[model samples]
Target: MVKYLVVFEKTETGYSAYVPDLPGCIATGKTKNMTEKHIIEAIQFHIEGLIEEKIKIPISKTEADTFVFALK
Candidate 1:
C-alpha cells in the first residue's frame, strides 16, 4: 500500500485536511478525529477513481517537519 502525506489544518469553522501527493483530494469535518476519518475516506475514494480511470497513481514524495522558535 502506498502511504501519502496528509495535512490537517485548523480552520475557523472546522478542521480541514488534504493529501499532498493526491491533488484535489481533500476533506473537512467538525473535529480533528472526524477530519481524520474523512480524509481517510477521501484518499480511498480518490484511489478508486484513479483506478477506474486507469490513471497512474502518483508516488508519495511529500514529507513534513516541525520547527519551533523562541519568542522574546
Candidate 2:
C-alpha cells in the first residue's frame, strides 16, 4: 500500500483536509474525527477513479515536520 501526506486545517465551523500528492482530493467535516474518516474515503475514491481512467498515480514525496520556537 502507498501512503500520502495529508494536511488538516481547522476552520471556523469545523475541519478540512486534503491530500498533497493528489490534487482535488479533499474532505471536510464537523469534527476532526469525522474529517479524518471522510478524507480516508476520499483518498480511496480518488485512487480508484485514477485507476479506472488509467492515469498515473502520483508518488508520495511530500513530508512534514514541526519545530518549536521560543521568544526571548
Candidate 3:
C-alpha cells in the first residue's frame, strides 16, 4: 500500500484537503468529515491519472508546523 500525505486545514467555511503527491488536485467540503471523504476519492482519481500518464513522481513533505498529541 502506498502512503500518501494528507493535509487538512480548518477553513472559514469548514475545512479543505489536499494531497501533496498530486499537485493541483484540490477538494473541498462543507465539513471535515466530508472533506476527508472527498480527499480519498480525489487520491484515487489522482493515482489513476498518474498511471495513465506514466508519471513517476512521488510525494514529498515540507511541513510548516509541528504538533504533538498525547493519549488521554
Candidate 4:
C-alpha cells in the first residue's frame, strides 16, 4: 500500500481531504469515515495516474503546505 499524506478538515457540511503529494487530489464527504473512503479511492487513482505517466510522486512536505490550510 502506498502511504500518502492526507490532510482532513471539518466543515459545516462535511470533511474535505487532500493529498499533499498529489496536486488536485482532493475529495470530500459527510464524515471522516466517508472522507477517508473517498480519499482511499482517490489515492489509488492518483497513484495509477502517476505510475502511468512515470511521474515521480514526492512524499516530502512541500513549502506550500505550511500556509495552504486554514481548514485543517
Candidate 5:
C-alpha cells in the first residue's frame, strides 16, 4: 500500500487535514481523531475514483519532519 503524508491543522472551530501527495483530497472534523478517520476514508475514496477514471495513481514522495530550535 502506498503511504501519503497527511498534514493536520487546527482551525478556530475544529481540525482539518489533507494529503500532500493527493491534491484535492481533504477532510475536516470536530476533533483530531475524527479528522484522522475522515482523511483516511477520503484517501481511499480518492484512490478508487482515480482508478475508475483510469488515471495514474500518484506515488507517495512527500515527507515531513519537525526541527526544534532553542533561543538563547
Candidate 6:
C-alpha cells in the first residue's frame, strides 16, 4: 500500500484535489469531505488504470509541511 500526497485547494464553486505523484489524477466536490471521498476514488481508479496499462506505479516522494507566522 503506497501513500501519495494529495493537495487540496479551495475554489469559488467547490474544493479541488489532486495527487502530486499521480499526474492528471484530480477530483472536485461541493465540500471538503465530499472532495476527499472523490479523491480517494480517483486515486484508486488511477492506480487500476495504470495496472491495466502495465505502467510503472510511481513511488510517493512528495512531502508537505506547514509553518505559522506572526505579524504585527
Give the clashing pairs for model 4. none
How high is the CA lDDT of each candidate model? 0.96, 0.97, 0.82, 0.85, 0.97, 0.98
After aligning candidate 5 to the native by TM-score, how far in Å is the CA of 50 from where it should be?
0.2
- lDDT string, candidate 5, 1-72, tens digits: 888999999999999999989999999999999999999999999999999999999999998989999999
**Which 10 consecutive positions of candidate 3 have the poorest summed lDDT?**
56-65
lDDT of 3: 0.82
List runs of model 5 lying over 4 Å from the truth.
none
Per-structure clash totals for the candidates: 0, 0, 0, 0, 0, 0
Off by over 4 Å in 4: 60-72
Position 55, candidate 2: lDDT: 100
TM-score of each: 0.96, 0.96, 0.75, 0.73, 0.95, 0.96
> For residues 10-29, could you state the per-residue lDDT of candidate 6 as single tens digits?
99999999999999999999
For residues 1-72, what per-residue lDDT tens digits would candidate 2 score against the true structure? 899999999999999999989999999999999999999999999999999999999999999999999999
Give the residue spans of candidate 6 off by over 4 A.
none
State in Å the error of residue 14, model 5: 0.8
Ranking by lDDT: 6, 5, 2, 1, 4, 3
- Model 1 per-residue lDDT tens digits across residues 21-68: 999999999999999999999999999999999999999999999999
Q: What's the distance in Å from true for residue 64, model 5?
A: 0.6
**Model 3 ranges off by over 4 Å:** 57-65, 68-72
Candidate 6 weakest ten by summed lDDT: 1-10
